[model samples]
Target: MFLEATWPLAPFVGGFCTVRHTLGVSQTPFDKFNVAYHVGDNADHVAQNRRTLDSFLPRSPIWLNQVHGGRVVDINESNISECANNQLDADGLFTRLTNTPLAIMTADCLPILLSNEDGSEVAALHGGWRPLHKNIIKQALRFFESSPEHVSAWFGPAIGPKAFEVGLDVVEAFCNDDPNYKGAFVRHPDNEDKWLANIFTLARMQLLALGVKNIYSDDLCTVEDKTRFFSYRRDKQTGRMVSVIWRKYP
Candidate 1:
């Protein structure tokens, strides 16, 4: 139903991360566990699915509108109720409060979870190429209030480099920003200007450069795993899967 990632660095860094697949009661296309309300999934079905998700979580998760931008809001007691009714317009969420889960929805895009060594701070990011180009990860990192060396990150399911074909503009977006990023793209054999962009590699490079020494990726490609995930690039109108993270109380 869901995959979980546990933090082993410290007991105080107490939180668990998980991402759901299309393995629930949701109908076809959404199949099951479709959490996004904007994707035209039935409101009742989506609501019920969320309730099921809430049952597993200590507190309700903070859902975002996810405009593919870099803004990250800190979840607080007040924001939780507001987010339940109306989602926040941001690509990332971070919180220091315990039992407050932060969630990011994705389909072919990356869902990233971050935590500090002491388990005092945790964050979730929706990392699309657009936001990656905009430095959303860096934006999210700023809220950690800790040095990058003390932070650990986990990359969730996304379109793999081999399957994610792109135009020269996509290649240029990162390469133009930094020449070192050229390694993240490979020119397609059939098309001189076309390239295959590696989302995971790019994300790792960004995290490493930011001084984050501990980084991990699930290496699950949503585009290739039809049975487990929803890929907008693969299904076009498919529903989204969510990656959630939160710090538990000591």
Candidate 2:
């Protein structure tokens, strides 16, 4: 039901990625445990699924109106109400407040959970290719009062390199940003004009370049793990699993 994030951080920081489970109410393509309402799942079913997930969380998560950009919202008591209403249009969320859970929903795009060494600050990012190319990870790290070396990051399940084929333009876009990113792509096995991109590697490169060292990642591939996850690339219309992070009250 949950793929808990395993990383070195103060015990107060908590995070996990939800997986599809038979117990949820979403039907057919959504199967079960689909918590996103914008994915064409039945509204009532989505609500029930969210409520069920909320039961395990300290507070209801602040869902984002993700646009696959670099914007990161600083979540605080002042704007918590608007964030709860899902009125924020951004791909990343950061907060220092205890019990305020931040969430990012995705099928194949990567979900990254981050926190300072002592767990005083935490953040969640939606790491689609567009956002990554736009330097979303860098944007989120800037919210931390701690330096990059004091930050730890955990990457959730995503479309792996073997299945994430892309065009020359995609490869060029990344390589143009930094030559180091060239290592994250290779010629597709079946198509010479296409390349298989490694989203995880690309994210790692960004984090490493920004001086963050304590990085951990899940090797699970959403496109290959049909039984445990949802994949939009595999199924155009599908449900979304959410990755959430928060710091418990001291």
Candidate 3:
């Protein structure tokens, strides 16, 4: 849907595109569209899914080995030799070059896409609570050589605030770093010390702090919509969805 909206057989496939979803061969939840070999899915299915996804985009979606950390990597320096069967030490990727699609796979984690005012460069980041708490946005904001005001972002589907429950330690972790984090957390109804976090709300806070106000949010809750998206929080075992963005080749 993103590609169809962006480029439609424009100047041949010289730019980049992104895809998300874990691949599995006839697996219950991961029946198809799994792009990564991780998450206990069938490896061959993932490879085949990659081939199927190729038809929709100009370049292969550069995937990440997400570790729920704030580590962001420049695409030029990415260690492509690495495999993603296990936890990846990094969670975000950026690229200023064309034909390099930035993508992240997520079930419940937020998928973030960034673009400069001129649309010269693009990046994608996976933001679970861990990555958000770790300040991945701060890193991404720093990595952009362009002015912060010129940067625009799109927030994809994720586990909404109503669905996310966290312990006091989680709240304390954010507070310890900056008191501004407190605004993102709200007391959970059933649990005294627990909190219900709104990732969208927190993300806006973070982006505003980064000085990027042009933001678009899908407001889709993956956990709530089983048919359109995959949700890890709603179901422990599930497939992931790919969210991506990139510039076109002139």
lDDT of 2 by residue, 1-250 (tens): 5898989764778899999875589998998999988889999999999999999899888888999999999999898887788558899999999998999999999999999887889999999999999999999988999999999999999999999999999999998878888999999988888999999999999999999989998678999999989999999899999999998865
The TM-score, computed over Cα atoms with residue i paired to residue i, of candidate 2 is: 0.97
Query: Could you tell me the lDDT of residue 165 within candidate 2?
Result: 91
Runs of candidate 3 with Cα error greater than 4 angstroms are: 1-26, 77-88
TM per prediction: 0.92, 0.97, 0.84
Using lDDT as the yardstick, the better of models 2 and 3 is 2
lDDT of 1 by residue, 55-123 (tens): 888877888889988888877777667776788789999888887888888989888889988778898
lDDT for each candidate structure: 0.82, 0.91, 0.71
Candidate 1 segments exceeding 4 Å error: 6-23, 77-81
What's the lDDT for candidate 2?
Answer: 0.91
Give the winner by TM-score. 2
TM-score of 3: 0.84
Best by lDDT: 2
lDDT of 2 at 134: 92
Question: Which whole-number lDDT from 0 to 100 does residue 184 have in model 1?
Answer: 92
| Best-first order by lDDT | 2, 1, 3
